[model samples]
Target: MEEMMRSELVSMSSYCRRYGHLKLHDFSNPSFKKTKYSPTKVFVVSSSSSNSTSPPPLPQNPIFQSFFFPVTPSPIIPYLQHCSRNTKKRKFTPSSSSGSVKVISREAFNAAVKKPSVAVKKPTVAVKKPTVAVKKPIVDVNKPTVAVTHDRGVRKSSSWVKSRLLGKGGYGSVYLATSKDGRYKTERAIKTAELSRASSLMDERRILKRLKSPFVIYCYGDEIVREGTSDCYNLILEYCSGQCLADVIEDNQGGLSEFDVKLYAKDVLSGLSYIHDRNIVHCDIKPDNLLLTPVDHRFRSNGFLTKIGDFGLAMEKGSVEYGNGCGHKRGTTRYMAPELIGHGVIDFAVDIWAFGCSVLEMLTGVQVWGEHGDLVYDDWVSLIGHSDLIPNIPSWLSEEAKDFLKRCFVKEPNARWGINELLNHPFLSSNQVFSHNGFIYE
Candidate 1:
């Protein structure tokens, strides 16, 4: 039995070296029949007959014991499979055997190889978590929404929404607004000032309230607005849809027409007459303060309405006592009168001086001292004396108009024409009748 075993191993080794990839199954035990494993074939090289050729000599006893006897079925089968796929043949010199070499046929080796044995484990199904339902939030429709209230303890008026800023001054800013309560047009202006500077706006509000004329800016009322953490005062006034007289003068080629000048002069004098009768003096009177109403093309010949605005510097006559000739010279430099610069007696005559300079700008397109530097009392005197030297004064201007301006430009405030007197002047009264024939009057 040992000699036969040696002969079988020698033939198997020879075949393994040639077709090294062939696998050898263990059939010595009955447990392999029921066990599970991958199926594979044990290949054998072709031999004519077992008795024809001698089997190769077996390797040394140590090499033989290490290669076959000690190896278990698990490792030897895998080694056989690995060697079966590798086609390279290994050279082996077997030891000399006593008995004749018995060659193993291909059919005999294949019939001896048994099927593989390995059991496969079945896969398991994972357990899933149970599902839970969620609840939705519910709201009541009968509940009233809370209105945002300010800290001033007064409810905000829904009448107007203040929007973009139109301008800014020493007190605060003026914003363009839209009316929500139909109290006024969507386009209106709102002036605001904090309590720190609210005194000026409050004074202007009082002055505007006392006066009501087509030649004056209209006022709505005063309201408190919450600006950040503090309260602000808002003085809502009429919005002038037209440009200022300063812009009007700039647009006209060589200044306004003589007829236009006369019409505007009449309007300004009318406003001044109304205010002067009330003992109020508009301390600041300049082209910028005179605003023209929107032009009405249907009555285009009548032109636009002119009104005196910006009463910030106005004061009632004889209200504030002027002593020591130290009154505040609060007005534009170009339109300030000689008496005003000297800190002399200030009265309605100051407005008359500014009005004269404004008229000159209308007819001549130039300020009184625009050509002269730092308008001194002497320069003013020389300016009125040489009236022809001034540019933009039409040669056709009536002598009555020149004389009217001369009275307004007088050095003595007492001798200047009163607002009422200027209304009856030939330059204004005569121009009114001539306007019927044509728009332009020489």
Candidate 2:
């Protein structure tokens, strides 16, 4: 029995060595029983069993049966061949009925070992920017190019007719306009200029609309008239039948009496006080701009009313252009105040200075600076800007008149008297009464 067992063990060892790819364990080793692999049924062949009449009875022990199974080569041979062809790790599962091993494929093993798949990200697309439309400014035809208070209704061109040309100047032409339907009992004066050159007229219209006084010329409204092929801007105003103060002075050939001067001064000062109270400065004040309208006998006998006009160079108080020498050339050089010509300083005081110059011109039929004949523009600027120079007052005038003129010609505008103070001066504040028809002035 021991010899037969030795021979069978030697035969199994030789078969394992022949098929080394199968990696079969040596059954003769003691550690083979203690391996982690589960117990599997294997078939063994004896070296001396080819022609035996009957196979030896198989082992009856279960442990020996697991290692040496007497099975035909058909089933076990094919399974071993498939396992030898594969390269992946092998897993064994014991068959319940036959106690045989089953082989797992490389594809099945890879599927079990695969990691969880990651989500794929989509590609980004480019976006476009939108275009914007630019808008142009819209201009209203009815609106004046320069802004002003239009308290009165606008008059149409067909509402009035131009009877004749009254005068013309840098501002344009003045016409005697009569209402076609006689809506206005008195004739209306219309100052017209080309649209491009009507800014000063528009400014005058703006200033006049806010001022309401018997001494200040009235402004009805304004309109745009088409003349020939060009458009013209028109300022509707109150017409004065009598001549301007400059014309009156010329006709007289000499200065008027103190009584007439006093009356005119009171009227002009009243208008100046009205405008100055409203924070307006008349940069240009002269005799040519004053209108004398003859009053009816019922109101006053042989009396004429004085109205201030031509506000083309007027400006609001504290405006940036007020004293910055903006309209210096347009303003009468002789009437410019010392502060205005020297340092571009201006205010209500400058108007007082100009008023003094206007009064001096009224006392004498000649211009205030007419004595300096043919002096160029720069020389006049130098002369007016001089600190020591002042307008000459006539020696023949009364002490009150000379003193009144002195108050207006002060070199320092701060020291010069205001309209309120001048109105209270003895020259204008006379106790003597003058009565003509029913009109009385004291």
Q: What clash count goes with each model?
A: 8, 0
What would the per-residue lDDT of candidate 1 be over residues 256-278, giving only the tens digit for each residue?
Answer: 87777887888898899888888
The residue ranges of model 1 lying beyond 4 angstroms of the native Cα positions read: 1-159, 163-165, 182-186, 295-302, 320-326, 373-397, 431-442
Using TM-score as the measure, which candidate wins?
Answer: 2
lDDT to native, each model: 0.66, 0.73
lDDT of 2 at 407: 99
lDDT of candidate 2 over 1-442, digit per residue (tens): 6676666666656644443212234334222123222223333233232332323333354444345533323344444555756754555443445422355666787887895677777777667667677786564332336334243332234356889998899899999988877555668899999878998898888688889999999989887766777767888899988878888888877787777888788889999999988888888888888898888656544468889998888877655545453444446777888877766666788888888888877887778877777676678778887658888888988899999999998998889999989999999997988876567766
lDDT of model 2 at position 219: 89
Task: Give stretches of model 2 more than 4 Å off.
Answer: 1-158, 182-185, 297-302, 319-330, 435-441
* Each model's Cα RMSD: 20.3, 16.3
Minimum summed lDDT over a 10-residue window in model 1 is located at 140-149
Q: What is the lDDT of candidate 1?
A: 0.66
